[model samples]
Target: MSIRLDLARDSGLTLSDALSVLLPTPAQDLSDLPRTTELVQPFKPFHDHFAAQGFSSVDASDAPCGDVILFVPRAKAQARALVHHACQRASGKIVVDGVKTDGIDSLLKEVRKRVPVEGPISKAHGKIFWFAADADAFSDWALSDMTLAGGYRTVPGVFSSDGIDPASELLIAAMPDRPGARIADLGAGWGYLSSRLLEREGVHSIDLVEADHVALDCARHNISDPRARFHWADALNWAAPEPLDTVVMNPPFHTSRAADPALGRGFIAAAARSLAPSGQLWMVANRHLPYEAALEAHFTRFEELGGDARFKIFNATRPRRRAGAS
Candidate 1:
């Protein structure tokens, strides 16, 4: 790949650099790496994948010393923070890589304003750039902890980082007066729903399942009650330890830039699989998403609770088994 060649030649990343890789995004064919390379990824799903591929992957940036190589995320604020952190932490060069769609060019320009940058080579719909990462430049780009209307803890790169998502708010507002004592908040970003559910009188436990480790980290800060259990996991793949009485979610519907409703459908299927026979799923989505057929495939009953022009919430029950399927 272009990133590999760029690192080997342009960035001067050597085998003995005590390398720490950051936020390595999901990919099918990762190149071979030196045995000492530490793959530092915050997202649970991608971390598991990279680990399974025999790479040394970790969930946090805990390395005592290493040269940092960060894949610039789509979030501009986060990318800046990554570069700044590497500059302060890495003993060797800090290499940055990203695609055009992710604003790599703009990132290069912004980094150049504060420090000397090198070799912004364009390739494979993206760019690769590197710098010496010294002298405390670009420190102010680090983002501070932020809050929404309800004082939920959030960071700039987390999903719906700026505030509580309107879809989740609508789902919460339209919720049944009483959700079951045992509830699961699938795709629970930053624990907004789980924290609110804990406020209900009879909620025995609220399981917050999210895929993004960064968002889950914020959730840990936002939720404090013993009743809230957190799992940094892919909602589509995580199974409930026991059958849950209720499932609640504002399921994510996209991974790439384009809208992919299939993601929401996977959450529906996972919810169906994790629930008791009589369990119900309380969920919300944008008004135009086509989750009705998937809901019909999984649940025998569907009721539209409430909505505005932008969002819709539903309560579905009686998990159904498809014909000729186990």
Candidate 2:
């Protein structure tokens, strides 16, 4: 991103003095951008990361701006939707930057078809380009909330946006008939498990804790039961409002394309901290990832429930107290 910006500046690209908004940027140095720059990051972890650095950050933005810099997400439909939204919100240039793995070449080709594009400066296996904002040219690209087969509401770019995740399905089927009265679904994506858990008897409240703001918004639309509560937060740091009787999850293992088991491990630790002393944890995971050690560290006892070849289920009880923990 810095390379492109430098090249653009060398070639006489001058940004306006008004607000410049950057959407969906990861944790990085932003000293080069104008002080007026605001960040729009829907993912809670990244949003909090920037917020800690004293940058103006928000989960979403609707205000008009002098310019908009978009960091393309992996989802193609989501990338297009962001472009359309950027055009709608920007009064000046619209900068698009993305890595090759994220389909920057394809996005550039598609954008060129709609408007005149300039300076596709390439460096470090990625490309960056800019174009004048023309909202009319990309009107059809605006995306609305999608309705899945079970009447679930979702939007582009969220995890498992297309339909219910198979791993989550496995966990749901493996869950005990009456798991607990007070429960939390850590890393809950769009509340699919929470919705199904609501069907079970003796469920007093189900907290849907998710990091993605967009997914949590969909969860709100899909769930209307009074017992369902939604929280847009990083599950690694989030604590249940009350000591949970049970925690259910198909914890996310990836922050990017590569699988990271540490994310799931963090979820297990967080769940243990949120549960009561005698509380239980019910979780599903991919077959190959190792989480037994983490489970053992956090809980007194754990055993495999049941799962097919692709996924495994575990039920753990008796969260262990830390040495110095009160």
lDDT of 1 by residue, 1-326 (tens): 34544455745545344888888867524565665678888878788888887888888775555577778789888888778777777877787878889888899898888778777777788777777867378778766888777778899888999877888888888876678989999988888888878877778988899988889989999999998889989988897988899999998787778999999999988988888988999999999999999998889899888889998888999987433211
Q: Look at candidate 2 and tell me the lDDT of residue 228.
A: 93
Q: Against the true structure, what is each candidate's TM-score? A: 0.93, 0.96
lDDT of 2: 0.87
**lDDT of all predictions:** 0.81, 0.87
Off by more than 4 A, model 1: 2-17, 321-326
> In candidate 1, what residue range of length 10 has the lowest lDDT sum?
1-10
Q: List the residue pairs that clash in candidate 2.
A: none
Candidate 2, 158-185: lDDT as tens digits:
9988888999999999987898999999
Question: Cα miss at 139, model 1 (Å)?
Answer: 2.0
